[model samples]
Target: MIPRYTTPEMGEVWADTTRFGRWLEIELLATEAHAALGVVPDADAVACRERAPQTDAAFVAAVSERERITDHDVAAFVDVVQAAIGAPAGSWIHYGLTSSDVVDTALCLAMRDAGRLLVSAADTLIATVTDLATTHRDTVMIGRTHGIHAEPTTFGAKAALWALQLDRDRTRLRTATETVAVCKLSGAVGTYSNVEPAVEHHVAEALGLTAVPATQVIARDRHAELLYACASTAATCELIAVELRHLQRTEVGEVLEGFKPGQKGSSAMPHKRNPISAETISGLARVVRSNLLAALQDVALWHERDISHSSVERIIVPDSTTLVHYCLQRLNRLLGGLVVNVDRMRDNLWSSRGLVFSQPVLLALVAAGRSRDDAYRIVQRNALRSWEEGVDFRQLLENDADVTLTPQQLDEAFDLARSVRNIDRVFSELHSMASR
Candidate 1:
């Protein structure tokens, strides 16, 4: 992945040094696996392990430069290791192994590390959202449907939805990574025609991977699943971000992303304090989704394998992981520093002039023996009047001729806080959360 889309740790995951290091590790492990099964000299395996690390940054750079002439990345990498070990041991370096054996296995190693990071980032985001949810669980606000206030809700309930989704997203990424973490050293075309099946299993186990029955490659479906996992996580972050953006809008200033003292929202408009971080996460999410499409296309290949998927994987794998990691990390920070106005939320909740209570009022009317349609018509008539005249809805309902309810019933109907009184029950299962 490019620096623009990558954090330093994630950048290191896709770095040349990191890439060649895994290749060398797998090559050495495979050599020992062969030796353990009496297929290769034990001395050769030891010597190769000892020398492979000596092929450092300069050596990896030279091998990368050599790739232009060979037009083979794995071969260039093998050449560097072979040269470092020399003679008889060099001969044992990549014996009975095809390019995909090293490339795919090394990719698994890198992905395993990257997956752990992504899962951790997700966990942190979930925890942060949980904290916010617990704190604001009782803070009432007007919930919207299709850009119109629909009913009363608590800000904590909204955060709880995000926290639960991110917990699932964390699990999804972890599962997808495991699916992609399998190693395949079954020689070319993956029949173990050249290398024994035991050798593949032995090497895979040593590398902390499970070898799968495969084609020339480890199959693109696993890779596709990993991409989809990242896209799903990105989509979740975007959902949270989109909501934050709406909440931060000038007309609906119920919540806001942190604004540093030196931060500037707009060059011309001094009053502008935009939701830049949320907008950025939403933009990056689109890229993650598009990458999943490319990965899905990679699932179909020419016969045993093809290079078409290889090129795409090289870009999408790291890019998708890095992008999702960034979104997760940034969202956690943004939420931690979030400025939530309890007063503003209350103001917005009542801004609809008590019409947010219409549903409860309608239901109360229906429960009192009126037909559903008749109750709805009566409620909608008063609700519309409140909308047009800015009159309180409860007052309109109280004055209606058809309304036989006493002041007590109207109090239950118009009480916005009453609607969210039981919200703490929703967080009961989340004991690790602040379930106040």
Candidate 2:
């Protein structure tokens, strides 16, 4: 992943030093397990454990240089660690174990850590959206269908919808993390021909992972699911960003991405204030979504194992996780400082001159003994006249003799408060789902 989108904490999780440290820990744990089974000397296991403290930056550097000569990463790592531990302990370091046993298990540790960071980012974003919904629970706005005014709605209801989706994203991220939190130390072909099953279990327990069936490596389905979760969450963030971008349009202007002091929206246009943050998020989301296809493609490999998935995974896993974390954090900040124009929302709601209240007026006519077809004609006639002539719809309806609604019924039909009466119910349902 590029430095521009990588958070420091997530970057560290996939760092070379961290990967090497995990690799060495798995090696030592397997050695100790062998000692417990009386397959290796206890003193050699102790020496291996003592040597772990020395496996730091210098150790990682040596492994890198060795890889240049050996042309194989895991082999180079084992060679360097074995030389560091020396003699009797060095002989037992990689005994009865294959390279995938250490490499695949260590990769799980890295992915598990990265998954936690993504989950935490999702939590922060959910909180920000929930607060927005709660704060604007009564802020009314126009609801549009096909870019035409349809009814009166609250901005709070829009935000509550987003919060509910974000809650689902959080659940998916947690589940994906759990799905990949597994270790597979089974030897080549996954039959444990040389390495015992107990060694795999011991390493898995020490690393707080579950030992699962495998063929040279843990199944790619688990990793595919993790990427899918990231992609799904990114798509959700994009959904929010696209809406904010539309709201920030000059014609709409119901909301704006918070612009910091001295921030320039455009170099050539001085009066411009753009939704750049939301646009950036929308762009990054595409990358995360595309990575999911690569993960899905990795699910099929030749026979028991092949290196085809390895190269692709080396790119997708870290990059997908980093991009997701960055996008979620950016979205949280964008919403936290979002400037909602409540007064403008009100102006926009009534911009159509009472046309949004046509539904209630139509229903009132039906209740007053007018046929459904007759009521539709009466409402549509006045609505079209009001739409084209810039006259208030209610006034037009009043002048129309075909409209049988009484004065009290007309007032009730155009009531903005009545249109949003069920907003509280939606919020109650949202809160209930959140608590669960």
TM-score of each: 0.96, 0.96
Candidate 1 Cα misplacement greater than 4 A, ranges: 53-55, 432-436
Enumerate residue pairs that collide in model 1.
none
Clashes of 1: 0
Residues 166-198, candidate 2: write the lDDT tens digits.
888888989988989999878889999999999
Every candidate's lDDT: 0.88, 0.90
lDDT for 109 (candidate 1):
82
RMSD per prediction, one decimal?
1.9, 1.5
Task: Name model 2 segments beyond 4 Å from true.
Answer: 53-57
Give a tens-digit lDDT track for model 1, residues 94-143: 88999999998889888888998999898788889988988988888889
